[model samples]
Target chain A: MKKMLLLYVVVIGTLMAYLYMVYFREDNGGLSENAGLHGKTDERYVMVNFLTGIDYWKNSLKGFEDAAEALGVSVEYRGSTQYDVQEEVMVLEQVIARSPSGIAVSAINSEALNAAINKAVEAGIPVVMFDSDAPDSDAYSFLGTNNYNAGVTAAREMAELTGGQGEVGIISLPNQLNHQERTRGFSDTLAKEFPKLRLVGIEDGKGDQLVTEQKSLELMERYPGLTGIFVTEANGGVGAGNAVLQAEKIDKVHIISFDTDKGTLDMVKSGTISATLAQGTWNMGYWSLMHLFHLHNELAEPMPDWRSSDVPPLPTYVDTGITVVTESNVDQFYAK
Target chain B: MKKMLLLYVVVIGTLMAYLYMVYFREDNGGLSENAGLHGKTDERYVMVNFLTGIDYWKNSLKGFEDAAEALGVSVEYRGSTQYDVQEEVMVLEQVIARSPSGIAVSAINSEALNAAINKAVEAGIPVVMFDSDAPDSDAYSFLGTNNYNAGVTAAREMAELTGGQGEVGIISLPNQLNHQERTRGFSDTLAKEFPKLRLVGIEDGKGDQLVTEQKSLELMERYPGLTGIFVTEANGGVGAGNAVLQAEKIDKVHIISFDTDKGTLDMVKSGTISATLAQGTWNMGYWSLMHLFHLHNELAEPMPDWRSSDVPPLPTYVDTGITVVTESNVDQFYAK
Candidate 1:
């Protein structure tokens, strides 16, 4: 009778454990580390970009990190740290192999990264794009400024600065998708909205201040009557401003630049640059990770008709927005 | 007899425990965390800097982290994200309250931070300075480029760029200790060596690009024969470059800028600016941490001379060197 009692106890214990295991087993899509002590997780996310050390990405990275800190998770910063796209792809592939909980990428070339991004998605990793985007990729969402609208805003500001009737030029990096869109938006808006403002020339600044200066000078020499120059990036903005100063056209030529880096802000304050567009850089970084965290955790919850491809409860595109920074408010944009 | 035996056993056990505790107690200057499991020390080091988000600190911080990874310790980066000295002091005070194993600081002002730095040292924390220094403070060692020598090099490079005979000026942040040293070096060298090259003017750029440009333009206008300008900082360098470019003097004026930031390097490669000085920034950060780890851990050793002030055996000043980046080798300086 004592032996029988022992057997019953053993059977009951085994049954209890089996039931608990069955009931508590949650789908993780075969990823995610085992839950830590006290049912906590130590999942890590990553933010990727090219030219990672530039001031351009500082605010965005801070937002990504702040979100991670609030959620009790960890985030790592990784990137090409150069302008090269191949390096970005290689870094992405290596990161995917590590199977991070999520990835936020700023694509150097829009279409070149689709395959690598798709591979990460296929492996059940959540991916989001920020700052720059690969629109066709399997990224769950895109979080950044509406580049075209920002360009239109720049055009309107330029028109005001130049009184809408003058020859203007664009100093841009022609190959970048964002710059391409910005150039199109500026030219299109200028042609449509302000018919008298002529875009006499477009030159590639190559996103280098000196190159922008050289190109701006060439544009000026090419069209001596050029009364305005729109630099599609920060470095180019400063370069164009310099070119204007060199040509002794600081008063005659009005410059509209993008981004509120120290260089551009200084130019704007000094009236070398008439205006600059400040992107909601922090919003892009913060919300991308926030969305990724929710998407990553959603797999552990059950809902009818929940599909891997259909990540619900979050918008796929978030326009983080931008603001026009002039001398009047340039003080607000200084690093704090 | 039984009571006596029990008493003897208790006495021996207590003696053994006392001996172990006394012998194994390591001197950490009363600052380091308790040793971790299996004879490991979970020491944490911190690097404090100003303008925390700028690209200038990125390489140095990477070096600090790399050393920590190799040594199985952790490092934290904290600093004033803005160029504010009070903010830096506040951050340092907060870090001191944590009683980290070690601290590394880059002072924004040479004298304003002495009291705070000395307080950290007095609290038994190992403090080292990198990139910049508080020469009057209680920092154990300073690991950075010799600012005066770097300046002298810039002067020589500027002289060479201008073919030895031309009017040149300086755009510098005169209030900064390092910038002041650089300006002195450039001016002294020009007076002593480049007899034909006249130092026409020295206007404060305030380390802002636009300010530098304005100052540079004034220098040029004040001295139309100005064939070269020595910019003591990177932002100012580019600003001065822009001024020369805007003055339509790209070919006529030679710019000797400091640092290998992308802006300066790009200008160097495109021949917009003449050259830049690349500080051994990585070395400054890596060695500062490595030394701090040693200083913090040495008190635990049986070294008789190890004391709070003695700091024991490491050189107090480490000359982290600099390299000249011209068009011939500008490719080496691009982000890897």
Candidate 2:
């Protein structure tokens, strides 16, 4: 009887152990059975971007993340606390030092980041530019809103608003490449397309509200008949709006600005500003990161894939898009 | 002479080899001094979202990418081509099969994903929710906008737009948790704060243009005295604007929508729409990924360390922000 009882005990213990192995252990495994085939360990990559505290950059980062996720890789966001070139450069250096699989940058200064970008590429790290481009840098591609085209569109819209003939002034960030392109586009368009319109004065807002306000006030003073003001950047737009409000020129001084910040939208609704341009910011971030991930993982080759296929790999410069925002469609932007 | 020649050749060869080792070889090593610190192999992490095509997600992806870069790790993105739950779930399942380091999900359906999400957590993978969330899922935390508060603000703005007393209708996506919260807040505020204002109807737009248009047309028919219409999405606002335009109710009907899509802005300028609420979409995406990366890397503890008062850990939920976009500030949003 004792021998039989011992045998039963041993048998039960063996079965319990087997059940634990089959059920709990397998279920607890980190990798599930449905997971796809794994790639070689060496081919892993990560993408980096400047993400937080900036509205304009949201779309570009999304593009990057989407591409990275599709490729089964990783990405990161890093940048200056403020829009300072030196701070951006330092952040870039730190990112490069980390030797990420790749880097996607929106250059605050086209010239300032030349050395750091080159160093990364020289070290076998792939770099891509989005939103704002550094034309002279070693970064492989630029995916962003076509600033010049957007400018042309803006100029046309301005002409339509001002009845095709008026003295208009511009407040812009003179140093940034993207803003410079926009300014050029606006100027060239006004000169060529809108023959009746006069481009009177161009002022540097330094992308600051106070500076934009001061410059706008000065322009209104200098050109008393200034019919319209085009300001780039959110702060600049608010500054211009404030100038108009303080000057009590709501009806006479038409305003056009860049971005979709609250202050800009409010002015549009109240008729203090006429219209604004909205960029396809999401496309910039998404495509830039996608390009970076593909290059890093060897999933999609760099541009000049030169292969004639149904879907071309990707272009070096992708014109995301832009559109005019006006009061007629302002309700479409209100949060529920 | 032969011996002398051989001896000279050997000496020259030795010098050349030394030079190559010291300079040329080192230069051609394909690895820089910074590479050593960053070459450490680490687990991969990824985040996936629905509506991957939208502009608001860019910054969040950047934050994820930045964290991956800083951690010397990798990350990726995945999503449905459209805002379809089945497609998102398929993508999630595919990602789960690969068993990444961790996953960050922006849940489109709070309840539908519970099983799959739990499966991932059970498999030992950490899961975090960002932007829109699934509260019931095993996600560690929800990092996104405080949507309810945003709705309250919107309701207040609506009252102001309608002069504090009138009949208003809502066009909203009823199923979405975030939108549901927004509707609740808007309705609650209208009932509590604006005594003279009455909410005549709440219509489901399904977040589609034609559907929203149809819904708005029906609402207009039912409530001939409707003073305002609040739409929850950009496309919905456009649809509502079209309805109002077709019905020639511009002077009688006021519209408010969500997001800064161009269509909404255009309506705002044209006086078809009244205002919009712009959420800090960029911040939501950026910070969600940042927190996920930090948690995955163990760079910072899961919870704040009470003893270390120098740098506190990140909070679980972050209210990025909300802004009211109207004609008064419309010029500030135009492109430069």
Candidate 3:
């Protein structure tokens, strides 16, 4: 009977101890020592974009890596070497096959990448679009600059440079989503805000410097009163700046450009371009990874049928924001 | 010897069991059973806004409550009884005194509430500005519709309604941050985007229907060719609509306005107002809380000296976004 009593005490004590540990955790409100602000290092995420080697993607990549570090997770960067939509789509499929924890993409072609994005999401992998978006896709959210708003900023800047009274023209890649939105925003703002200023022409730069230069020359020749030009891309900005300089119309025509590439920044510094618009590229990368991490962990709920719902657990869109860089702020934009 | 051997077995077994549990939790990447998508119910948050009794605050308040529920945290709604800046500042100070986990504020005046906001931050309370912002304050984030962008949307809609050609005017409260941004956005867009549309006049509405009506009538009389009106506030929208209707120019003069207030909705439904821009007020509340939660838990790290840092953990500004409500979508705006 004494031996039986000893066994009972031992069993009961162990059971109570285990229960106490669990109860303590529950009482502490889910903040058990094991639960922290960190994730598993093995949990991996991937960021995919087109024109993989460009400096424009550097800030965004840094943001992604920073988020990975914060979350204690691993990340990989993969993209097409050039501006080929098919190649980007293929790369996305390859990444999906490897089945990372989540994927963040900057779609090269908005519609063309929908199938692959949808496939990944349907297979239970969370996906988000950053920098550039394929809006119609099943990707959960978009984190990027609102291209239209960016254009409005450019137009307002152009108006300021020309004293709100001058004829301005646009040189842009008319086929690109970002460029189109910028053109519309610039044209719309110019028409509604500065009645004294007129949009004299809109010519497609075809994302080529030579083409933009020729288009700029044609516009200048066609509209002698054109006192300003807005280019929707970096190459076009440089091209247009060159055209203005070669034609001796640099000072006479104020040029507002996009991006802060070395060439574009040089023009802004040299007084060839009045100013340029810089996007929140880094924010795009950081927020995209955060969103993916949340969705993957089931920490976010999409507000069931969010299409009809008033509010989603995650924002449908996040305008990362924009900045106006001119000669005064141009030095900071240059690569170290 | 037998008794001693039995005691050693029990002791060693319990130790191994405890060690195994701890090791398992760590190996699973801190996702212990106690860890979840929730916080302690005692972790409370507060949301403060001016004009607390108005219907405008209802949706935002609901969003705050919803987020609190999701996070298993307690929340309280507090604000000033009227659109009084000093009163709002007092209310914010009171909330700060209680030392809630966080506070979200919609400032009544852009600059008047800065001191109160700064005090909250200095006291170590995470404060976020929602709907309206004090840009220079130490608040960590501003989660709301970009008023300037909303104005731009209004301008674009007005141009479409008036066939991109007409004389337009604005009715707004000049001193309000939101109204000022809307007016600037509208005027800038009109002057830059719609070359054919002329903004003839801008009048202060004082947020009173009668004053707005008087201003609208004066504008119509001043510009005999006026074809559009963009009111920056709901009362002004309704007042402007009434003036156009009474003047027998409802059909001749298209009106684009702000908000989804019943008055604005009724005008849109009855065709007195062509359309109204609805802000993402709900998003403002939801995101503000989420940001606060992250900051309170130290899950986010705002880059040291974020003012000079290229990237901060939190976005400086979030354009919650806007929706254009027309006759077809007017019914949805009515409170159920």
lDDT of 1 by residue, B16-110 (tens): 66446534532321112221101124688999999998899887897787666545677899999998989999999999999999999999888
Local accuracy of candidate 1 as per-residue lDDT tens digits, A59-126: 78878776665455788999998889899999999999999989999998888899999999888888
Report model 3's interface C-alpha RMSD after superposition on the true interface residues: 6.7
lDDT of 1: 0.78
DockQ (C-alpha based) per candidate is: 0.01, 0.01, 0.13
Identify the leading candidate in terms of lDDT. 3
Better of 1 and 3 by TM-score: 3
Q: How accurate is candidate 2 locally (lDDT)?
A: 0.71
Residue B63 CA displacement from its true place in model 1, Å: 0.8
After the best TM-score superposition of candidate 3, give how far the Cα of residue B171 lies from its true spot, in angstroms. Answer: 1.8
Q: Rank the candidates by lDDT, best first.
A: 3, 1, 2
Which order, best to worst by DockQ?
Answer: 3, 2, 1
Which portions of model 2 miss their true places by more than 4 Å?
A1-52, A301-314, A331-336, B1-336
Write the number of the candidate with greater DockQ, choosing between 1 and 3.
3
Kindly report which residue stretches of model 1 are placed more than 4 angstroms away from their true locations once superposed: A1-336, B1-41, B299-305, B308-312
